[model samples]
Target: MSWTTPSDVVALLRKRWDAGAYLGRPWEPVAVPLRGPRPGELADRFGEAQDWVRRWEQVDLVRLERVRTGGRVIGTNEIPRRVWIDTFEGLCALLRVGPAARRFEHLLELTGRRFPALTGWVTAHPMKTLEAADDWERLLAVVRWIETCPPGLYLRQVDVPGVDTKFVERHRGILTELLELRVDPVDGVPRTDFAGRFRFRRKPDYVRFRMLDGSRIGGFGELTVRAEEFLAPPARRIFVLENEVTYLALPETPGAAAILGGGYGVGVLERMDWPAEVELVYWGDIDTHGFAILDRFRRRFPHVRSVLMDQDTLLAHRVHWMTEPKPTRQPLGALTAEESALYRDLISDVYGPAVRLEQERVRFSAVRRALGP
Candidate 1:
């Protein structure tokens, strides 16, 4: 009654085969012993013994271990002790995964001949290899291109036939693992961003800013400059805010620059090379995520100050308070003493869970007051 069926043994081997263990170690022999009904269980479920025989006969590819057991009514009888599938072929046949297994075998054989260094990788990522089995040819084609092509080319610049930007981007994750195995150390910076790590040209990052006091920018009121080329103006102040409306409506202040579009993008500003002592002000919503962003922003730009993100401002805008569905509870190590106290209150739900005040909710007069004369 509690016997492991023929289908169950096949399912078990199918798992291992799909996992790539079969081809991962090509020289190693395969052996899986099925756990069938014990001798005592067989005699107890003698009524279903005929059904067991029918299931056993169906799995003709596997070798069986049999035993003689006595039942009160059936007398001494021969039954299967366990089933052994010792060969890869037999396991594949029983599981009916022969086609997939054969493909994996071919892949292993080809890797051994063409890319012997990937032997360890094949052993480590059996499942990944199987998932990419269908795409293995295209994937290897890209790998081969990376190996031969000049370093620092953009993904699109890869001149390999049938290998395009989308093809490489879609397979970046696995390619990174595979690329690292074959790519020269001089060409790879594994610790950097994807483009840098693989020595490819990444899409350039740009800084969008508004010249607060003077129209030093060309054409438009705002200037969007590539982060690498954007020279920081020798202006006395730089104000960064998240809200577009507030950024656009900012009243001109002498010797100041307004950086719009805020979130956890302070890292991107690192390339801007801002002056060490200039007045840097950040204005964000009076919420957990806002403070969290400000907290991270300060780590890189420690001199950066908060303008309207204070307890007084939060209390003044209670009418505009809204729920922050998923608030951050981690301490903002970069916050000043006062700001840290307010951040604690919001997260602890002293005002209640998810309480927040958007920077846009504050009056323009309040903004001017915070910015100062």
Candidate 2:
């Protein structure tokens, strides 16, 4: 029916709770806009419409307000015009979530008392607060610890009674939001890295580099050292390949190191000070993401050179071209003129359909040739 059902009226109020309306303000007389039948609609489905109105009147969730109407078939009638949600308690009962609303009220009271600053956060994310009801106390404790203690202690040093380092790490995302309100930029922490942002000792970001001169590098032929340790040694001419086998198989070049990582989550590299100094040469697939990675890497190190990601390499491996399922079409600001041109071709369906030349599929000889002796 076109008229609002009891379920539909309940759904309207439920959306407000979903959007964190419960946390915003103390309960006031609130109303759900009753989109019931117009007078003409009432005339068409008179009996069915009366039953729909009766259902709203019977429901305890909402009080139906009506208006006296003059009609042709029915001499005079009172029709439900609006729905009123009288109180927050009624709202909870209507939604069948009384316990959750009580939990949020407790969190609000606690946040206001301990961290007056986070009251805004409480109001902003009531739905999240209720969702994390079980762990909300611990989340607040982590926030209090950061605010109370000096901002430079490692995350491990956080001495919350029950919560451990993994707990903080597990909830870094929500913690970042809570902690930001407490900690200022005077503390040396990056929001991108949770541990560093709150001055907690963090697990080192591994740099898997194959030593072209295994004898000189003083480690295994293929080594995945911490970024800090990688910086300890002087590195020159690092070849960061996207493909794993290709990174592992590259021939020894007197002063070169082959680097690789899964996916394009390269945020870990932001922690290191070494890739900035060394001559970085990237060889990725001839695709949009490959170019996007190259583009981002260049943003960090403008001097970083891209190898084997050219139109020529793509054309040479025409028979091996595979479709890039999802192509990134955003204009890459950091790509060089040539790299940007090739990226354009790859995304625009210029060279066959969704054409891509993966670095792994590139001939071994071509790779060796690119890494010229």
Top TM-score: which candidate number? Answer: 1
lDDT of 1 by residue, 305-349 (tens): 898899899998889999997899987899999999999999889
Superposed Cα deviation of residue 299, candidate 2 (Å): 5.6
Highest lDDT scorer? 2
Q: What value of lDDT does candidate 1 attain over all alpha carbons?
A: 0.78
TM-score of 2: 0.75
Count steric clashes of candidate 1.
0
TM-score of each: 0.88, 0.75
Q: Any runs in candidate 2 off by more than 4 Å, and if so which? A: 22-24, 32-57, 60-64, 71-74, 83-87, 110-117, 150-157, 185-192, 206-238, 254-281, 295-306, 332-340
